[model samples]
Target: MRPLATRGGSYVFPLILAITAAAAVACALDAGPVNVWIFVVVIGGWLITLSLHEFAHAAVSLAGGDTSVRERGYLTLNLLRYSDPANTFLIPLILLAIGGIPLPGGAVLVEPWRLRHRWWSSLVSAAGPVTNMLCGVVLAWISAGIDNPLGYALAALALLQFVAGILNILPIPGFDGFGILEPYLPRELLERLRPIRPWLPLVVFAILWSVDGASAWLFNLGADLMETFGGNVAQAAVGLARFRFWNV
Candidate 1:
């Protein structure tokens, strides 16, 4: 087996962080178009979280005996290594902008057969969304006491990440939630569901975007969770409003 690289992290991650930081700082100083900054912050921050989310899946799978993850460069924070750009970024960004639903993006392929145990598959699936939750919690904590435009933007981003985690954990086909339960499900049941897995996420996103009640329920659920975690839901709304500049 090949040893995992222990050297420096991919420069792409740091560059993304730098760009997001620059945008946040600029917004804080009232430099440019508030809408532009809001766009940058939300989009860049979301990309960062997506990278981490996929990395978590790969990392957990690696630990669970899938050395192929390292070979595929999934351990690195390079966004290109994750998945198709259209699915990983474009579609999710469109959904976020139009409906305020942060659909989970990016995916890591974990060879279930290579895993040392069946439970490893569950852990591999759970790791991605759990990372999102942890990110939401940390961002929520950071923005909790700060009452500023930047803070509001952070709060909004936190809410999105939290919602993304929630969406991923839903027990539906093509989601990590289903992946978590797949190991315990019967083989025949899995076979029956296999054909539908590819299009399930798209259908789910379409429902969430096109149906007002469904979108409202999801946003409300996310908002409630954000408030419960001490995030400023009102400010998050403001931030989202700014992020969706076309609506303003």
Candidate 2:
């Protein structure tokens, strides 16, 4: 474990460099009026949102008397400390380029049994999505306060983060939301459901692939909420990158 951590630390910088280079090359080769600034903002917002999600998990874990996560240094915004390069960087980019559904990676090295309360564990799990929603709201407010392309881009990024949060929180196996709900579900029920865990990714993928209209409906609903407070700015931001690309 110690060697893995050391190796991971060593490889982190190079991996990020490689991923950035790839993204830049992909963007340059694509034929369109790509808004580089908007892409940057959206990516930045997404990273920030991911950080918050992981930190929330660590925070709740600490509050629940779990020092394991703290020892692992996961209670901060440093994405490298938590992210799995394969899931967070490589796979997502590949899926995005190939027009497939992207899946974000979850946090690193934490033992749930160390927590003080099982309920707090659930709360910690749920915190990621909630934090993303809060970030979206804040970004929407900021976007409404200004009137410029940059503002629009920022708003759009926020909207994407919001959608990501909601999607991640869906109570499916291997998702943080499922972890949150697991504590509350009866142990016997979970045992019965255990057999279905391995097939969850396929099920989730199918849902995303098959339910085109459903995603649109969810986006529309999110847009409506954003518009209620921020008006057109919110709508524009939320819709700007609705189906533009998949960011795993």
Candidate 3:
């Protein structure tokens, strides 16, 4: 099995770098109460999303016959335990304080070799995003059912989770979705794509940040889906909170 450090370097490092840089730039460029609220909502929403993400990873890994994540103490909601200080704390804090980017939080661990089935491995990798989407759906449901500020907050959180889930599921080289897809891809194709793997994180981040339309489209789609399932109340709550600072 490949070492965790190697896997992270190959897949996670570039995302950290790109997001951190973009965050710094966003902080520098945006100066408004709305931006601040968006930052706060993102932070709160990301915290919940990330925790579930790591939990999904650890859970699936355990089910797949890997005790590595549990052995390493990654099976909990303890943020500090899963977080890499550099990736989760320092970079985000610096960007938020100096650059104005919304720093995200959450973590998960898995052992590739221990996964017995390639498709299962793919499912495990895909679990995080699925969990996020579920979370969004639940939140949206709650928001629509209720008639209060709490409902609005839930709606916002749902939006964040939905967006994050979709973003992570893009079949880019270094993303989790790619990892899930990798095991099922033809060996020849996988091999051919290997050399370019390192660049994928950067490419995904660029596409996400540079293209406002893409991001908006994703968010809208998430909202649409959530509305479809959550009914009118949830849809209204989300719409009401869409431009507001915080759900309140």
Q: What's the TM-score of every candidate structure?
A: 0.92, 0.75, 0.69
Q: What tens digits encode model 1's per-residue C-alpha lDDT throughout 1-248?
A: 33334434468788989999999997777666777787788888998998888889999999999998987778878776664657877788787777778987656777899999999999999998899888888888788876766777788899898888889998898899999999999999989988998888889988987876997787788788887888888878888888887777
After the best TM-score superposition of candidate 3, give how far the Cα of residue 79 lies from its true spot, in angstroms.
Answer: 2.2
Worst 10 residues of 1 by lDDT: 1-10
What does candidate 3's lDDT look like per residue over 105-217, in tens digits?
33565677887877778888888888888887777776676554344445666666666677678787756778787887899998898899877766655565577675567
Q: Between the candidate structures 2 and 3, which one is better when assessed by lDDT?
A: 2
Q: Which stretches of candidate 3 lie over 4 Å from their true place?
A: 1-42, 83-106, 231-248
In angstroms, how far off is 235's CA in candidate 1? 1.0
The TM-score that candidate 2 achieves is: 0.75
* Highest-scoring model, lDDT: 1
Task: State residue 64's C-alpha deviation in candidate 1, in Å.
Answer: 0.8
**Candidate 2 per-residue lDDT over residues 22-88, each given as its tens digit:** 4434434542333553454445445556667777878878888888777777766666666465665
> What is the TM-score (0 to 1) of candidate 3?
0.69
Models, CA RMSD each: 3.1, 5.4, 9.2
Report the candidate with higher lDDT, 1 versus 3: 1
